[model samples]
Target: MSTEVISQIDVDRTRGDFHYPEQHTFDAGTGLSHATIDYISDVKNEPDWIREFRHKALDVFLSKPMPTNWASKDLENIVFENIRYYLANAQRPTRSWDEVPDDVKRTFERLGIPEQERKFLAGVEAQFDSEAVYSNMKKALGDEGVIFVGSTDGLRDHPEIFKKWFGRVIPTGDNKFSALNSAVFSGGSFIYVPPGVKVKHPLQAYFRINAENFGQFERTLIIADEGSEVMYMEGCTAPKFETATLHSAVVELVALKGAKIQYVTVQNWSANVFNLVTKRAVAHEEAEVKWIDCNIGSRLTMKYPGVILKGRKARGEVISIALANNGQHQDTGAKMIHAADETTSNVISKSISIGQGRATYRGQVHIPKHLKGCKNNTECDALLINSTSRTDTYPAITVRGLGNSVQHEASVSQVSAEQIFYMQQRGLTEAQAMSLSVNGFVNDLVREFPMEYSVELKRLIDLEMEGSVG
Candidate 1:
């Protein structure tokens, strides 16, 4: 491998797609078994209780079968036995960037993580492969009694808080992927906001998959105490590889009384990656929870960020944007469950399919018969770029109450030759016109994203449209 300087993350060949030589010191070889689970737990030096938890979760994972019914037949391709469960160069995360391995540090530097942390983020966690290379929280936040650290540290240092909320939002047995993540999870964020304290800036995490034939399972949990507020953002990327890669993560959020929590994710995976993720939140009395998700590249991705409105006057919202180009499938949506009277939930989803790619939206909203004064709204829109592109939507909503109400809407549209020609006539090239039109279709939703991610979305769209116009 060359140590030559790479200028930028491009689209077709090297779109944020480059890798360094592997120098791993810990690897739980290629297979899924009891030995693998024990190896992971022993390496982490976890307590006996946690080791038992992983074993039980492994049983659940083995009991459940692949989800080929709804996740497309592609689920059959994931050979769990061939995936290396754990790979890391260090036993624990370093608090200083200077302490990170040179290659790992360069990876973050190239992705602009350090600069972003200095500019806006209140804290940043950089995870490589299966472990965090660097984790740091702003001194100001620590002074305010806010706990921001990797999940491993959370369990070891703040057991009282970590044990109280971990897996409460999304249980290990909730699904097969969640169970898998529980059994072999590693580096992810764990945050606890003290009551009545609001973090002024966002906390961010960057997950990079730098190895081949590997599985990266990270678990994250966040709890916002009474009247507190927080916002978290995550970005993911992987280098293209000939072998398939797997990334399964479980994320849970808890917004206590009158608190607010916002979670955002932008996934730009390689085409050889299978991105299966499960994320959900719980909102208590007068609390609010929101999920902002963007999916750009993957061979197949299935994720639905849900919220359980468990208290009166609670609110939940999910706004998602997904793009599938060439050989990719973006299966994404939201779930909202109104368990209390006066609760409210809303969902807005938009997807774009280009080339032979496919995008699907799956939404579920439930307001039980006992719930009164609850309201739910859902809207899904999809765009098809070329004749070969594909999109699908499946929404299931159940409402039972006189005072409660629910509204639903869905639309699918394609970029007509007239629309592209209209732009091309204005001195823009064909590819440029197509890019503009695609961006226009989703500009409304893009505005909901923070400025930096919005710019990244546009750049990804432009790159995908290049040479795609026939």
Candidate 2:
């Protein structure tokens, strides 16, 4: 119940400044219209059915009104007509990195995509602006029947498999942003693991936005066949622009019977970008799906990764962390829908707000009356670093089935003077003390991240904490 808050915190101003010159082979120009949709479909040479789907989704996006109550009033500022829907430097993805355009390759090089792939990633895909410039998978995994490529490539090479579960998990009309993404979506990963195959290493994709007054919409689909296992990770960053930028992506995951799929995302958009995304998964009988999400460095972000337990004995989990600095709002949480017997779901969310930033958690858990032996647990924690910082939690749970159990817990705490004083007495600078305290508060969750990401997260936190305290 302690409500004390600090006055101010130091913020790093140059963490996301890497930008490359815009080099596009094709551009759809600004605004959203039927002609725009037609231009996009024509550029990609999409099939008639796919083109029709895009037209339908565009109508849905236009007909639906903006959400009134779910997000902050800042949503009113988004000018759809001012955003360039698509930009691409390459028409087709290249299997060799050398074939990638020089400017695009330089951007990824600055982001360390090639280095990461050389060190540990089993496959790597890099998207610049609106289309993937480079995509490559380890030959050994491909020999094992693993399909890792850009979505466009997936549609072109393996339509039979791609069409089977592309929109099955999350329909195009799920939400306004989803519908919009469907209309002008461009580059994202498409992954498929064969039955009984286990990918020994994780696959990764990196998304970069390099255009001004532009919007990046990527559509991703992942399918793990029965008795298969796979892990996919995605990282996104955008250059700083004076005008507003938009990034809205849709990701769908399907884990078949006895399959396991783990999806991880680290989003570090520039402070001028609005990052709104939809990610969901479907777990079949005895299947398992997990989402590890980290959000930081955006003007405003609203994301809620969710899972649907569609078959008996399925399990789903979501672990999330968010950091909101000045001029930022992180509204994030998770959803679990239990439609089968003996299913389980868990959610753990942690957030930190600094300066005038705000963080909110909105979650939902549902168990129908006919489902039996269902279980759910949700925990949300928030930390305040400035007097003007704010945090909120809203959790809704519904259970009507016999032998069903649900638990929810939330807490908001501010940095205490006593802890800072104690650390200062030990010869640490006040800023260092405050940083250490904040790090300790989320240490447990930070350890859950992969080593490289964990190191980077700590560095970001330390930078944000420098000169925060007198």
Candidate 3:
């Protein structure tokens, strides 16, 4: 219960050994150019359309300037010419864990992928650097017409399904980073569920970045057929590096009529990484889509997962939690667009700032005039652990329909010394007390996560809080 004990907890948290020796067989040498894109396309042996798609997206990326108005000035430091766009040890993914390369398997073992798969996951995909080294799904789900594989495999084997929805949700021109992802995206999940089939267990993916001064661009797409239900979860981590790393991904989801799709992400990048991603979903008639996102560590992260209710009675929801430590910035939020009658949406965001860290919430909710009976609710809350810590909230809600209703609420609170003292008197250390208080702040939303993820989230928050106090 002493201050020294709490301080030690902080030290232990940062003592993790995440470094691994680079064992790549191929590297697309540093920089972004037409040649790099063409090489990536040729290496994949992709269809001509896809190869052309990459070229067009590269042009779009070149035309757009780095966004400076809302993002941190750190964005200017990303030297596109110095970052290696692709690095892979193997060309094909292995279905059996034993077949995976020893070093790659060891990396996943450290991340708890195999154990988690053995315990409860319906499927598991592991991506190391720019390639999915391992991918497997439950035979039962496969029998029910579930297709879960890497994007490359999906396009090659099931073009009918993959081609129809690949870039429909989030177009290549959606943003600068999205265009970058489209140009050189290598490893990401591709999921499709048949109509009326409900996946009982969650499908999971783990992405690890092991190389320094490199970029990982994974493109993921999910399509839930009519009356089907599926839950997909992804986790990401990068080893500590002195040089900056880039992680730019694009995820798109499509929920068909009367279907439900839940997408969850637990992103814990190292302090030297820039995590910029674009994720969006579209909900059809009577369908539902939800995004549960948690951002813990990154030098600068700018991500906003969004949903578009495209049909009558569609629904969308976003629950986000962000924690910023010293020398880190967590800029995250959600977007919802109601394009049909009787659509509904909700947004709940929570942030924690500690030791000069900064957190920002930028959200948007819109309902057009033609839509009737649309509804929306948005809440943003922030907790500051130190006077030097800072937080910001920007919620933009636009409702043009007469029968639509929208509500927005925001609050900022700081951890009080008295509360910490009281908890310490109760036999808890300062670190424990702070961790408990911070956990309680987001307990309501954390419970929304699956049991395993919630436990891991709590552990991450505890470690983060340890570093914040004292």
Candidate 4:
């Protein structure tokens, strides 16, 4: 399939220059000590059980050795004692955006959060550094049985619902990073829609990292009740830094019988970040789950959103896009497991690499022997901007059922210098021309995003392409 082209719009190139709040200094002190964990727990007034959970997780993090075989090698350089565990510029989240600290509000305004919320979002949560500062839900949405807020708030206010599902999908012992997130995780979104309720607009959460040696571990859980539908979006940005920051998060989603859920993420971290995240969902009878993920601008990113089709007639789809610029590595894909009859899945992945960057897709699709009528289709495409860049696709598909149908396809291509030379001859500067071609390479998957976000994604791609020409 060809990539979709995005129409050029008048953009405020100056807007990217808007400054954000400085990292809260007092919270910048390092070391993963018991005292630090206690401070975080006390500040949030968390339950005793959670404090103990953090301590247990810290032990696991300290004892566990970094996996040597994974796509990430930079993770070995992380000094556990050199990172700050928690930070908060605001003691509590404000219901009204204006009530948020002026500097914090300015940060969101810089990112166009307010404008996006006003124009298209049903709800918006803004988190800076380590804590959610502003969370607002449209009254009409709140009135219709929707719960949208930070994970901390969810634990405090809705303990019954929150406790039941927290870590249920991805337990602390699932993996090293997942355990770490369970221990010190804070400031993520928890959303639930009542049975049969369908949200008209997307809900979004924006995460910004303002500190130098900080690790942001946010935990998000989304549950769609029977016959319900909900769409959630997440975006991230961090300023340029010399030292790498760690962002390892765990996201779990559950789609009940006849329900649907779509999770979208657009990450544009600076090159000084190791973005390792775990996201998975469970779909019941006749339910559907989709993951739309875009990854760019991180030193190393390892994320593969997965889904388990647990009941008959369930379906899952994952559409992903990644771009790796100089010194960056984008390692991401998806997983689909069929557990019942008549389940279906599809995975479409696209990646672009430039200036010695590397991109890889690692994915799996499994259908057990008892799962009859299972079907799956997988496609992976890679684009190389320069000869020095690299890309790879590794897919493992297992079909055990007699009637299962599975197909896998992969293609890799390099942008011909002729394409750029052609565009340059059309009156476009070299940078603009290369940007247009790279944008064209990934536009089809980006079009799946909301109009506003699609525009932002293209602009970010363009910004990364600047100075890319040799």
Which lDDT tens digits does candidate 2 get at residues 257-360? Answer: 99999888888898899998999999999999999988877899999999999999999999999988888999999999999999999999999988888898
Cα-based lDDT for every prediction: 0.91, 0.88, 0.92, 0.87
| TM-scores for every predicted model | 0.97, 0.95, 0.97, 0.94
User: Candidate 3 lDDT, tens digit per residue, 1-470?
Assistant: 69999877644575333767887787888999989988888778889999999999999999999887667899999999989999998778999999998888988887789999999999999999999999999999999999999887888889999899999999999889999999999899999999999999999989889898999999999999999999999998887898999999999999999999999999998899999999999999999999999999789999999999999999999999999999999999999999999999999999999989999999989998988999999999999999999999988888995999999999999999999999999999999999999999999999999999999999999888876666
Candidate 2's C-alpha lDDT?
Answer: 0.88
Which candidate's lDDT is highest? 3
State the displacement of the C-alpha of residue 143, model 4, in Å, after optimal TM-score superposition: 1.3
Ten residues in sequence with the least summed lDDT for candidate 4: 1-10
Q: How many residue-pair clashes does candidate 1 contain?
A: 1
Candidate 3 minimal-lDDT segment of 10 residues? 10-19
Error of 4 at 276 (Å): 0.7
Model 3 lDDT, full chain set: 0.92
199-254: candidate 4 lDDT, tens digit per residue: 98999999988777889999999989999999999999877678778999999999
Worst 10 residues of 2 by lDDT: 2-11
Q: How do the residues 273-301 of candidate 1 rate in per-residue lDDT, one tens digit apiece? A: 99999999999999999999999888999
C-alpha displacement of 212 in model 3, angstroms? 0.8
What value does the lDDT take at residue 1 in candidate 4? 17
